[model samples]
Target: MKARVTISLKNGVLDPQGKAIAHALHGLGFDNVGEVRQGKVIELDLGDIAAADAPAEVEKMCTQLLANTVIENYEFELLD
Candidate 1:
């Protein structure tokens, strides 16, 4: 099974990268661009975990390392 972890800054948290990207977009003529929030996607290939348990296993990984739960929120999807 394959698992994908999507991690992003929690609401009300500052996002410097997102701010830079938004600024660049406006400079490049993307005037209509609004708030930009940046996030990361981590794709994992699980060999031992069963499909039904992939999400739980991946959640553990996120809590351990993939995401900084203090300032970020995470969600995961399992794929065959």
Candidate 2:
């Protein structure tokens, strides 16, 4: 199975990178854009892991290494 994890800042957290992106977009004539937020995507290959256990396994990975649980939130999807 393969897993895709998405990590993003929680609400009310400062996102300087996202702010920079929004500023750049506005400078490039995308004035209509508003409130941009940025996140990261991680793809993992779990060889031979059963589908039933993938969620818990991936959640452990996220909490342990992939994300900073204090300031960020994560969600994942498993793919065959």
TM-scores for all candidates: the values are: 0.93, 0.96
1-80 per-residue lDDT for model 2 (tens digits): 99999999999999999999999999999999999889999999999998999999999999999999999999999999
Flag clash pairs in model 2: none
Q: Model 1: runs farther than 4 Å from truth?
A: none
Indicate the residue-level lDDT of 11 in model 2: 96
lDDT of 1 by residue, 1-80 (tens): 78888999999999999999999999999999999999999989898777777777788899999999899999988877
| Candidate 1 minimal-lDDT segment of 10 residues | 48-57
Q: What is residue 46's positional error in candidate 1, in angstroms?
A: 0.4
What's the distance in Å from true for residue 76, model 1? Answer: 0.9
Residue 7 lDDT in candidate 2: 98
